[model samples]
Target: MAEQTQPADMSRWPLVIAGGFFLIMLAIFVVAFIVLSGEDTGMDADDITETAYMDIVTPLLVDADPERGREHFQRYGCTACHGNQNLAPAVDVMIASAGERRPPMQAVAYIYESIIYPGAFVVPGYQNNMPRTYSDTIDEAHLGDLIAFLSGVEAEPAPEIPEDDPLSIETPSGDDATDADEEFALSADGNVILTPALIREYEDLAEFLLAGANPERGPELVIEYGCSVCHGDLAAGILAAGYAEMGQMAAERRPPLSAAAYLYEAIIYPRRNTVEGWDDNMPDDYAEMISTVDLGDIIAYLLTYADE
Candidate 1:
């Protein structure tokens, strides 16, 4: 049997095996990071596209309506940061500072750039954390509306919302809606006035507790609750928003309502805002089976998928 020994390369087999295992683990970690970071709110600076540049700002700009802009300033929840909170500068202040920060750029153009691409030019002393995809989130026609308002230009008659008004709240009329809106108030203009009270109110909404839910439980609940039946990858569902992803979207899904409120309402009041492609097929009795605490947990769990 002529020594009957292994080849020299055989000595490297253990290293080769360990290296292969390490590569597999690295690939899995990479996949997970990609999946985790892939939730797109369309707000990244990188979200800017040529389409945005190609968009004719002139049409919206030329016809910008300050009054409408003023209205949208509230409607899109722009006030959350820009209002007395002053997380961002006042529109008038922005207009003045914009010219000095980036000269020959024209204050209006600079303002436009700041909006869709806020990272392009940071305000003198402010954090460069403004969302960069406002154009994607708002109506195209309203760009001029916002710009006109930012510039303090004169106004013309405003137009109706091309999309839902973020400041307004709507739900199916029923017992649940009563419970849901008990703490909320509407302005004379019919917009829900979000206040610090809303935060307090949301905290006390029940025991299910989305505020501090362990999101790890969300996927299990979806399967346990049969949400996976329709919204799951294996199911033939409408709305296309799978359970976990829906939590990420819950906030923007129905504005005026916080993410917790929207999730609660969507579960309890499925008859409202029926998805266009389907009849209101979501069972209305989920609230009966799921405890309020679990409901909060479920929402908390779902939101785990959302970006920070």
Candidate 2:
């Protein structure tokens, strides 16, 4: 028998296979073009989104003015707790001790901290009462201006005493002894009062204290100084030791030493002006143990919260 011959219809099979292959290749090319284009466009879209986000989030730096800050102080109620023109005021009425000497720069530093981290150092009696006023309400530039104004303030002069006339002198002794009293008065005038010398000493101490005061070192000193013992941990407003008697104390008794500036003074001059009720508890001899510079550091550390 002869071999079977192939059918003629088989001639179209190769053409059908070639057509199918061409269609598949075209489909793959289309997919590749779409995927590449999408990736490139996606990157461009992401770049635009990132730029817009940065513009919204970045904060702008501005120059601060102390004069404006002083105005802000009055407008913002700082004097409510501190005082008005007379730096010294009645201690019990939310103000600090009268006649207490504090450096202007140190006060500025304190103001800065109080504004940022208001709760960090709660003036003993005023804890929880001190408002949380900084974070988002005021920006950095305004805070700096407030600091500038506080630092620029200088202490006012003391009033002068008048010479006494003989008639004005009160005699504790009922019997009159004019000649003897005159000699005693002359001797009193002749003796030099060491007040000027004492003032000079205090000035020197302040200089020493300020030399090492930096905000960076404040937190450590807070704990080291035993402030945490009474002001609560991290100054979050918990009364530690000796806080219970704050109310019984006179207005001058526990006048809010929780502010960074007030705290600095409380530590440096513990007995300078006793807080009415808590006077017995506070240490009176800081001069022997801590330096002025260390006190400044404590002030700096406390200021960390002014913006908090």
Candidate 3:
């Protein structure tokens, strides 16, 4: 009775089942690759996006005084590895050349990663001598500020002098050249002495930092701005670095600017309000020195490690 009941299409069933199984296996491999690659395995797309988002948002919450941030760079011994003012012969000579392969703007991200997780990406030319991690030495807030400052530095451009200007070629032996140099250093309002080229460079750097190509650069810029001096090594909170009383007072009196929006206002209009214990006199020139883009980068960096 069973032999008589065999169906005409029975042979096709096995092939169909086999094909379906193969398809399922293929689909699983595809999904696995996507999941694995998208993960934050040291440096993945999600990690980069999170970094970019933080760079754009964190600075708005915290105030980062560029001048103070600059001092932080020195205090933390960052200059030992990065370089002095010019940023030419970087203290970490090996990394410097490696960074050169990419645009100085792109280099900011690498610098940021180096600060937070030094071993993540060992530049081929550089010795893996960077501190393994700054988890202890620097806090999240200050780290953001540092990233902001470094991004700003790389963004700075060479001073430009119009070839057509009569004063462009003045000899140093004469008063004209000296006068021109002096004038070039002064800002339009005469409050700051940054050169036009420097200003342009800062603007470019700020723009690059905000673009999200390198989220790590934002934190590096914060360091460059010198915020660490008053705000401590990582801007975790000023109190631990001798501003404890002031930090407490500021916390109570102020409206609480510990995120991106607040930080932006603080940077752009530092003297807008005084926190409880803190002085109402934060540097006014931050408005003049830092561009909107750099401020965004600082904000982004802060979000990565800022305390809840």
Candidate 4:
């Protein structure tokens, strides 16, 4: 067979073209990487703020201000259910009976959890009709105050509800398997072991925290913790429809950062990364004011409507 020689120049052209294309893609990748991971810049040396690192410590100490707590107990409407009427056990009753279960006689801890996550335990013969919104309505500190007030100062007696009142029915005993109260079992130590129910609730909370953030709780924290004091009025905040738009805006303003990341940074280190057109008035004391779990929940709630 006569050898039909291929041209060397034509064969080399393919390699050259591929090399050029590869270089172009590599350059683009480099640019995107730099853009996405860039640190806070464009501010003067003193103007730069550090990230607000949260410590995963045991929740805030229960050294509650009893007087302040008492005010909070009544102001937040604890009197409505827990008054002398026995609709819900009175503050003194819960305190006096605090050691009746296996759980440690941490009266403050018990009352604090009750106010924040009320569904975890119900006093025997008491209904679990307590509102779960207190977590949303009150901050951890104020709740601690409430616990202090309930632990030290007795609550005023509730006026008995009339027979016709829908709320007058007594809560079923824990031995009643048909009622949800059965889950609240007493511990061997003669104290209430809220661990089982609490464990279940925490498992659900773990899933919620891992499944993105709790944007629903975010806005509420923002208000309860007074975040809007600096972030303009996030009271009405943004709706779901505005999330994508807000994300895009956050990306553009933040440059290569996702809106979620930006939001997280804004909370943890408000002064670290300042948004253009906004003042550097964000408080840096959030690490002390908000717990890590509460911070996560708040972020999750905010992201629900303003996520990346």
Candidate 5:
């Protein structure tokens, strides 16, 4: 019999099979990372302690007033993320959980720890998205009042500030009444004390951003905002930078930051810096169009795609 003819491509079959297997493994890894990392875990209950926040809490306890704290709660926008807002545990739920975790845990101490070190014991099933700025932005006594209300503890009445105080609305005298613009002071602590007019303006702007970035509704946002046009569908390529080819292209730039940080800087400061191949034509008005809270939601939405 004539010698069996051999095809030239036959020798390449092994290499092709090995390549196919390697790709399958890579895909499995990517999927596994996404699934596992998406499950948020809070700080262990054992680690949360009353002493950690005692320095700040001790001062407030002397004059803690639950009623006064309730007002501060709304002023600082704590309602924006907790309870019915569904971003974090509701006030009642959090207190209840604290009670369960450490049966002997004092309500005041638990509330204090939560406000000062939110990340210390993330209520199970809640994201650790609570801002850590409360300790600084809220005076210790005011914070105590808030804790007092949340923990159902009775507190003293907060001292009243005079209505005519600079932080208060002032009667316009002379030609200033017709000026229509009230004096606005930017608090040194970065909290904006909005005048009624400014508050209306803020509400208008917030409405324009579609009730802020609904991170849970991020997929649609990517399309609505046309993010995919420049960055590609982030959901489609979660690890875009991890590819070998991308590493070579990004050799000169600093290592990429967290998805939240990068997206935030990109939106607020479009001209500040940009990705390697993209143009800087992103509308400069987004800073004025969206609230910082909304920007954070967008970042949170985008972070869902992060491989990490």
Candidate 6:
């Protein structure tokens, strides 16, 4: 007589369906948010322009400039061996065959590999005579620009970053252990390799080397080499506060360095004696960018800030 059974429960079906619809809407919203955020930055893995390593500027692959690359090619003396020198395949020839050199490797990537790792894929009958130190010596941060030029793509350079945006140097301040100048110092000419061995040899430098240098040319060098990128536009009255009176201020800031000597050290090894309240983000490659004569000129120009 007790055959009681439960009726099919219809009450919970609407609740389950509502929950399922809510989850679907949430998922769609999340996907849309992600897509929009990514596109807002307009950056890809290859287009990332950040300087978190080695105080070098790694520009986006898409922002490469062929004209800039040509300047580097000629400035670096590629003609010495490749083109007119005829020791190896001309750069044009190599660039033309870049796509074919390494199967499946993109032409731009192949060109970049050739510059960075010349031995990555060598052409037959052409001994790998390209100097391996290019990555270290040249402004390799913009090597992609050179690669684009070689590949004949001629992409426009990355647009000038506004003052409000992240600087060409996107790295956080004081994050790089290598930028610290505690264990190493650069030579006078800025050509010396900085090593951490027990003994590091530095050139005996003069206290004042402004005698024969042309200070007039210093400003041009500063802008041309992109020092203005971090330091600001000197012509527009935009200058570092510490550098306002860097000549007289230099000695007090860095004792016993002599104003000129300190300037030399600062240019070659910026973080060697960083000024208070300033980030140690300046690239310590100024020495390589200028000649001894040119360095003297820059120092001479900087000394004028003392008189001002």
TM-score for candidate 2: 0.26
RMSD of each: 17.3, 24.2, 16.3, 25.1, 21.2, 18.9
Candidate order by lDDT, decreasing, is: 1, 6, 5, 4, 3, 2
Winner of 1 and 6 under lDDT: 1
The TM-scores, one per candidate, come to: 0.40, 0.26, 0.29, 0.32, 0.36, 0.37
Candidate lDDT (C-alpha), each: 0.60, 0.43, 0.47, 0.50, 0.51, 0.56
Could you tell which candidate, 1 or 3, scores higher by lDDT? 1
**Candidate 5 global lDDT:** 0.51
Error of 5 at 38 (Å): 41
How do the residues 152-188 of candidate 4 rate in per-residue lDDT, one tens digit apiece? 5344542233322322223322331122233345444
Please write out the lDDT profile of model 1 over residues 209-251, one tens digit for every residue.
6556677777787767656645778433432467666767777
Model 1 weakest 10-residue run by lDDT: 158-167
- Compared with the true structure, model 3 gives a TM-score of 0.29
Give the range of the ten consecutive residues with the poorest summed lDDT in model 3.
Answer: 169-178
Off by over 4 Å in 5: 1-56, 83-85, 155-308
Cα distance off (Å), candidate 1, residue 166: 13
Off by over 4 Å in 3: 1-62, 83-108, 153-308
Q: Estimate candidate 3's RMSD in Å.
A: 16.3
The alpha-carbon lDDT assigned to residue 131 of candidate 4 equals 62
| TM accuracy, model 6 | 0.37
User: Alpha carbon lDDT of residue 75, candidate 5?
Assistant: 42
Q: For model 6, how does the per-residue alpha-carbon lDDT over 196-263 read when each residue is reduced to its tens digit? A: 33111222353335667787887776655545434534312222443355665765654444567667
What is the C-alpha lDDT profile of model 5 across 1-308, one tens digit per residue?
A: 22236565886788899999999999999999887775543234554455644555667878887766665664444543452335566666654555465446567777777777777667777677666655655656667778777776643333232322222322223331221243445455322343566445434543444344566765555444434433443212331232222223332332233334335545654433445443233433355445456565665565554533
Instruction: Return the candidate ranking by TM-score, descending.
Output: 1, 6, 5, 4, 3, 2
